[model samples]
Target chain A: MSHMQWQGYLRKDGRKGIRNYITVVYLVECAHHVAREITSRFKEHPVQLIGFAGCYPNAYADRVMNSLCTHPNVGAVLLISLGCESFDRKKLEENIRQSGRPVNSIVIQEAGGTRKAINDGVRWVDWCSGIIGNTMMVPMTVNDLVVGTVCGGSDATSGITANPAVGLAFNKLVANKGIAIFEETGEMIGLEEVMSSRAVNPQLAIELKKSVEKAARYYSAMGHGSFAPGNADGGLTTIEEKSMGAYCKSGDCQISGLIKPGDRPVQPGLYLMDVVPDGEPKFGFPNINDTVEIVEMISSGCHIILFTTGRGSVVGSAISPVIKICANPQTYRRMEEDMDINAGGILTGETTLRDTGEKIFEGILAVASGIPTCSEGLGHQEFMLSYKTFTPLGPGCLPV
Target chain B: MDKLIKIHSLDNVMIVTADIQAGEHLHIRRTEYYFDKPVGIGHKVAAQFIESGGKIIKYGVPIGSATEDIQMGGHVHLHNMKSDYIPTYTYEKQYPGDANPSLTNQSINQVL
Candidate 1:
């Protein structure tokens, strides 16, 4: 048996972070350049840039941004405000400070323009990085880890290899008392029955079913299904077909609860993140792209994300590391450096499902223990946040 | 050891594990059929004859229904198979069937 443990940064809020990063957040699109400049100036430092682009106020955006800024992985925050946007910079800074992380805000207009704001932001980041470098590290067990799985650019091999392998790893994590999450309700369209059947209780089953229905309705209102053209080229005949492959990432564990984006899991078990926005379909799509969903998973406090791809998606989130598991042997050969594991070995009969699954599980531990993922090493920190609306989860959503 | 993989025993389609050229003979479960068109890797090929509007079973679950009769060894994709839950978006505007009213209850009942 393989025995492994990780040392993570312990936050004052009692949460453990696998990475200590100084996050520079842009409150609006106008402040993006300044925030980017601040983080870019300290290229050698472990700093990440995240932000919202909309000028209009959104409760969902506010909640997600707050969760991200105060994420355990983030040791400090530098919020760049355009001074006129509706993103509540004061509330964001206050929340970060309350989480016991060093936080500072620079308003571009108030600081006498772009040059002054950028200069001020750079100084704040430098100071924050110094403080983060001195943060204490504590020994963390597997139970302290919260891992999330997402499948992007999927093909037939995904269902046969990587997705099921992820499911196996998820099962192992859940068995070890670690939190496991699988999101993309829009992608889980036809697997509602299979998914609901794995719920811990009948009420959660209903909620699971309703969540998928909401996704179907939401996509229908947008005049398109969530199925992309690349999915078709990848041999996924329908959204349901793609969903069956995507559903395998959840493994065979009973789902403990349901949560919308930004809602943290209260217990160590499997949870389904309802990515579809609540109420009418005002936003174009629940998740505009794969990175948006990744952002939501990060907001939910995932220490690391297991990203499976068949058509090859090379992406990493700002706040969390992404472990890429390539499902297609051909894709793996083409992008070996970008993938962390080659699950396609199962299709080639060179390895069994259990072997690949264990590899993915081990890969997770390695990443949490301070190993940089292929995406991280390649500098693929892709961040995106959009406007949306969501109603708070009902009491029944989490029975435990 | 075949290039096509049957994900579930009950699935009526098999996914091509590698690119197959036209006229290539595929052997599955002691049965052999010749491919009439090039099938790319990750694409689906019919395991048995499927009638028009019949459900296409993959992973032992219904992914969609056949728009036309598909012979054994025929390619199964958007050109022939379509979603039963929601209208599948295709480049060309074609069938616009009403959403299946029984989808919700039927899917739940089947799994339960």
Candidate 2:
């Protein structure tokens, strides 16, 4: 038996959470500042601010909110409504109530505007913080966790070291009966056939291919692939090269299913998140930035995200923690404080890839046991969600 | 110990583990080699003669194809290779270097 042991906040919905966060949600862009103010004063607590800035209603936004508010990691949520927006706070409150979480709503217009709203929201947070501390802690194992992996700011070294190490860790996670998800189909353009070959079924293989093909078409019509100027500077020549590097993070595990953003996995195994928006190029770049991708993973119930970077990234999610794995030795040295694992040690031959993978697997357990990740310690709860379109997956999307 | 690695036996390039200066001497696959042009760490150096339009293999897969003939030990980058997939994007503006040029300091790395 494994020596590692930890307890998790067992939710009424039967899911376990590594972190219990109190989130202040803004229903529209108008209430964003007030929500921020309410969360700001409660800095000592794990209170995060999240919201949709759209005044206009969106089915996608509604789905994202329903999943995020009741995310296993979230213990309580306070909705801030501007009172004039189309977002249905009552529906959201009902969703939270059904999930068996304490939820409250504050309307800026009805709560005497910004000053009074912030004051009222703060009081509720203060009151709820006391009661939420009593959440039952249950013994949990790796099987109770859902982890996601994504790579960003990649350089040539990424594929050779950190990403492959992550792949090894993902394989370990799957072996231990944990759920592992890898995303960024936009970056997997050149490896569709090879990627889909690992799918458990022919139907899922076809869906994987279609998702990558969709990403290729979306970026092609957008006038550029997801490759960036920094990639060029980091010795990555083209999108295919970057894709090859990014693909290493998925490891060699069999893909159990394909899913769009805001969709949850039904079983414990490896999954692929098709983050690219469906249909013709419509809502701008599929993801305007990295936080959008992080938000999507968090909404899909990822308890923690494995983030690999060669150039180094500093951001974490609002509810879940982000573990940064640095791919380059020089980049790791340059940004030591920000990195959680120095997979770059593989580049200098100081450590083997499997050793780094072992370190990362331990790191995940450590963070899940309430040890603060570097991002969480630095207070990097970055969150961003934007407009995008994704038609539901076909019936054959998930494997039997 | 060698200052670079070929990653795979079939790879046509070596990944430099240490920054190589123009006058530096190194050993690749136990053969003595000299660097005539500098290459930064994590950058690629041709492991063998690569003809124009020939694929550059790494991790036993084709990352890209050479745009021009590259001699053994030559630096391989955007100047000499192109992706087999879609065209990569680039900003038209020239920016200064060395202070972190990717995303803002407070922002997460945004690459896909």
Candidate 3:
């Protein structure tokens, strides 16, 4: 048995954070440039940039932004408004203040134009960073952790190595009373029956099956499949084949519940995030790219993300750190600097699945204890947000 | 060690663990076969003869259907295999990736 513990910043809402970051948010696309300038000034500090791109109001965007601003890892928040956007900045600032984090806002149109607003934002971020530096540190156990897994740029070696290895680590985390989430319903088309069979109850199983069906219907309506051409170039023939590889990241643990984006898990176990848009397909696609899914995971309170890649994706989240596990030996050789673990060793007969899984589990603890991931050190903070709609989950969806 | 891997016991297809050349010989599960076409590292090869329109099994489940008859050790890909659940969209038809004039434009209205 390995006895590993981490030191986390304790928040007022009884949650612990692995990374203490001051987040700078833009309410709409117009404020994005100002927010970027403010964040760029703090190059040496733990600051992140995130925002919504739409000027139109969306209930789902409001919920997700609120959840992100008050996320456990975020120590303070700065909202940049263009003086005329539909996102509710007042309510967002109020919620952050209620969570005991310093909150400030600057409207570029009202604050004497561009240069003046940038100066004011810089001063506020400096003050906020100073206050967050003094927060009390608490001993955090595995039970207090919520980890998420997502696969991008997948190929054949993903199923044989990295995905199953992640599943093993997920099983270990859940066995230790920790939360593990595996998302991307659009990528899980054909594995619904097999996945639902592992649900803790029949009601939960029904919800699981329906979610995948919803994704299939939505993508079919879009006139394109969830799979990208990169998947084909990497040798994945069909959606079912990709789903089979992606499903292995869920491990063999019995799924406890289902939740949509921004819905926190009430219990410690395995859960699936339904990334598909509910009702009619209003949005162009459920997830525009990998960063959108990463943002959704952070909004659900994940402290860390396990990202498996075979074709090599180099993206990190705005709040949570993404641990890259490369599944292809050739890709790993070409991009070793971007990967944290070489699961491709399994294909080379250099390591076993259990060993690679244990390595990932250890990597989680190291990152939770303040070790910067490759993406983080390399300055890969990719952020994206778009319009999405969801009717609240059903009662049977979350029994815990 | 085997150069190809059968992901499940019931799978009749094997994933090539490394790039294989034409006229290469492979022995799997006490049976031997010869490849007539080059196969990429991550592509699939038939473990047994698959008749046209038959299901291709992998991970103990059907991934797609064979569009044409495939002999043992034959390379399986988009040219001979296709999805059974939904139409697999390619970049050539969806985007301006290539100038393959044979491809037709697909409308979202038609799919809906």
lDDT of 3 by residue, A1-400 (tens): 3447878999999999998999999999999999999999999999989999899999999999999999999999999999989899999999999999989999999998889999999999988887888988999988999999999987668887898789889989999999999897877886777688989999999899888877777877788656678778767898788887888788878999999999999699999999898999897888989989998988988999999998999888889999999999889999999999999987786876788999999999999989999999999899888999999997788765
lDDT of 1 at A320: 96
TM-score of 1: 0.83
Per-residue alpha-carbon lDDT of candidate 1 for residues A249-360, written as tens digits (9 for 90 to 100): 8887789999988999969999999988888878777787899999999899898999999999999889899999999888999999999999998778677678888999
Interface Cα RMSD per model, in Å? 4.9, 5.6, 4.3
Instruction: Please state the error at residue A160 of candidate 3 in Å.
Output: 2.6
Query: What digit string (tens of lDDT, one per residue) describes model 2 on residues A1-400?
Result: 4536688998999999999999999999999999999999988888999999998877888899889999999999999999999997899999999999999999999999899999999999999999999999988888888899888886677887888889889989999998898898887877776688888989888888888877766776777736678777666776666787788788777899998788888688898998888777777998887788888988888999999998888888899999999998889999999999998888677987788989999998999889999999999999887877778988777654
* Candidate 1 TM-score for chain A: 0.95
Q: What is the lDDT of residue B40 in candidate 1?
A: 92
Looking only at chain B, model 3 earns a TM-score of 0.72
Model 1 misplacement above 4 A: A226-240, B1-16, B19-112
Q: What's model 1's lDDT at A96? A: 87
Residue A202 C-alpha lDDT in model 2:
90
Each prediction's DockQ? 0.32, 0.24, 0.27
Candidate 3: list runs displaced more than 4 Å: A1-3, A226-239, B1-15, B20-40, B43-112
Q: Cα deviation of B74 in candidate 1 (Å)?
A: 12
What range of 10 consecutive residues in model 2 chain B has the weakest lDDT sum? B102-111
Give chain A TM for each model in order: 0.95, 0.96, 0.96
